[model samples]
Target: MAKAVWKGTLTFGLVSLPVALYPATESHAVRFHQLQRGTTDRVRQRRVNERTGEEVPFEDVVKGYELAEGEYVVVEPAELEELSPGRSRTIEIGGFADLAEIDPVLFDKTYYLGPADPATAKVYQLLVEALAHSRRAGIAVFAMRGKEYLTAVDSTDGLLELRTMHWADELRDPQQEVPDLPARRRDFNRTELATAEQLIEMLSVAWNPDDYHDTREERVRALVEAKAEGREVALSTGAEPEATELTDLVDVLRRSLAEARAARGTGPKGGRSGTAGGSGTAGTAGRPRTVGAAGTVRAAGRPGTAGRSETVGAAGTAGTAGTAGTAGAKGGPKRERARRAPEPPEAVEDLGSLTKAELYRRAAALGVPHRSTMTRDQLQYALKAAARPRRKLGKAS
Candidate 1:
């Protein structure tokens, strides 16, 4: 309504629906002033010439590519526009994709697609309704603001939303970045896998967006309040999934599949094992499954389902991914993480008769960083030293 970023005609088959591509989402993130710790003086950052230390204006800054140390190639805006790949007024429908192909990670910017002209409304509705009915996504290319974008168009609630995505090369190589993948794949077992899966199934349900919140974001706000009052901002060590590389891949995969199935509420008690095998994850509370002839087709090892199930942790709701169940929706590479729970605490010794607070203090003094994660009962034994610290076997009294 304010001003369209790019004006174009959405083309599907021979139908041309004139459309306005407007930004679909916005962030209301808060900003804060950087201040000196003791003086409360505001700290300011400036862009300056390295050699002269002269402050430079924002308009004077040019985008540059650094090829080597202290070496850069500055290119002008006009020159960049001249070399732009896709520059047109047409949103070309290159092809349609199974919605599952798109990875949530590759999604960059989203634009709401609306018919630009009154005459184009009919064809626009046709495309939107068709995509919604078929539950398919349109894989297309469009030129916007001198840049070419790979876009995915989905029709939701009578409006078409086009999401711009990253190219194949733009995505980072995970295989290169993560270490010890091979060794971690060697030692996993079936029982752990089954129990983990059972745990997931026992707790699985629908994804209500309201259920998830940025706890870190909320904590940051609380920290700000603490800072305003000049109180000790007690920091949380922050819960992170322990990274123990799996020693076995098969058990890893088996347990993961079971966990995902468990969250799926695909219990064999509710239905036959035959009905539950591949389709066990069907009937999730959020977004109903699009059943195929055999059953609901399962996407192998989706993101949250990775062996890193702890990544979602309590965020794992009882529901399915809704329309997002298809993992390969947009050429996003697929990888599986081995999801396993943390190991139990080591057994403690007897002769420990202290209050909980005192017991915790003893454990902290003994150098356990993960003490907070341990239960109070477990903490009691963890703090105990076996057999009253009996030094050497022969010299002990």
Candidate 2:
């Protein structure tokens, strides 16, 4: 169980409920200490006077407001604390508005609100139910830790979730910050748009937060472990490819669609039929092949030709034709049973070949669980599992 960071009475109109706030999120980032290069000595930071070049004691350090260049107005800690917002036990709800009206960019840290006492549980549940039904968030102001905060409280799964918000002036305008950004609108062909939509549909899957993993943190941990084991680490210095202008939009869309279909196992196998390399026929004698859940096929040699003689499991494997299915005792044709097997666990590319940044992007897209604590191998495994097609359940008769 987690301890409550704040305890206060939440008030709205005539109703009031005692509530406790608990942090909803925590950081899992790896921490490092500063050290001198090629040495075991730790580098310590010290606050010193620039003029005297003498270290300042913690008790002597005071908050200083810079009035002008090289001039500061020093204020004692006790004086500053006295001037700050007074400690308040009440979170006064000033107004309520539609939750959707609030921009997500303005939201900051979130906290879970729970009943401070068993006697106040009923009022807390009442407020939560009201907010959930009304689809509105209560905007409030509260003083905590010598500072005042603007916050919004909304209902989430039968509980109140409070989020601290930034003032309007605090947010920076991207238009002002970014210079020479293209403002001209670009036109797209209808056919190309349709093809892109098809590609998106083929690649679309249900959102699952568990599928993502943070590979960078994992890499950092792995580096630390390797260094501890006295292992040498190799660094890559590959140049990034220059971006090329798209000459033919339709051709690019067509190629993308083809690749997407191939990945989904819906595209035609091999090249044009009777012209050279076609997947041949989908018969038992052709080649031993198995289809994955996502329609990916695995077989021996080329798609249209046979090669080695190896036993292929229902889980899809590359092998010879005779070994694919069981032959009947009376010289009967081999029965090729189409069984629902798990998708191949191999990644599209080796995890080691990708950079930590690239792995982190993939992990974010997949919504892997506990990604911040995962290692490179763990991230790779998680990504592979996330990329695998989900097994279809047979309809119950």
lDDT tens digits by residue: candidate 2, 1-48: 789998988999988888899999877888999999999899999999
TM-score of each: 0.53, 0.62
The 10 consecutive residues of candidate 1 with the worst lDDT sum are 303-312
Give lDDT tens digits, candidate 1, residues 1-397. 4578888777778777788988876664557799999888999989999999999988888888999998999987667666744445788787897444455557788778888898767888888778766656788887766678888888767889898889978977655666643432424454455444444433333222343344456678888888889999767574444443556433333434433443344422332221232333422212222222222223222222211121222321223423222221112112222434422223433425555555555555444323443445545645543222211222212
Worst 10 residues of 2 by lDDT: 327-336
Residue 9 error for model 1, in Å? 3.2
Off by over 4 Å in 2: 57-59, 76-88, 184-186, 237-244, 268-397
lDDT of each prediction vs. the true structure? 0.54, 0.57
